[model samples]
Target: MAVGLWLVGRRAATTNQPQLATWRLTLALPCLALPCLALPCLALPCLALPCLGSWLLALGSWFLMSDLDA
Candidate 1:
């Protein structure tokens, strides 16, 4: 979350162009992909924690990146 926000902040600092907005969205997308990607590793309990944590983190990151009006 912190890093995503930091990246958004950095990008926002430069410009608010549609391209940059697209870039932010692109950067933010990994969060959604993470949970799905984690599924394959869930067969192992030890792998589950990190994947679950990543899923949660990514979900949170998506929210932080997404605008309410959007």
Candidate 2:
């Protein structure tokens, strides 16, 4: 799970005093947010068609959150 990996990685980084790894994670957060930022491209009304991909987003959210509780 991502949280487990993040926790283990954080503990390891703390113990190791890994400055570079900290920077890498910090940099990657913004890049991960880029797609979400661009998602406004889907907001068009007439031709955009919200119904087109609503189900895909639902399935994607479920899959993405599946490992959270574990």
Task: Say which candidate scores most in TM-score.
Answer: 1
Model 1's alpha-carbon lDDT is 0.58
Measured against the true structure, the TM-scores of the candidates, in listed sequence, are: 0.36, 0.29
lDDT of 2 at 46: 30
Clashing pairs in 2: none
Instruction: Single out the weakest 10-residue window by summed lDDT for candidate 2.
Output: 40-49
Q: How well is each residue in 31-64 modelled by candidate 1, as lDDT tens digits?
A: 4456554344434424554666877899888998
lDDT score at residue 31, model 1, on the 0-100 scale: 46
Error of 2 at 3 (Å): 5.6
The lDDT for every candidate, in the order shown, is 0.58, 0.51
User: Which runs in model 1 stand beyond 4 Å of their true positions?
Assistant: 1-42, 68-70
The RMSD (Cα, Å) of candidate 2 is 15.3
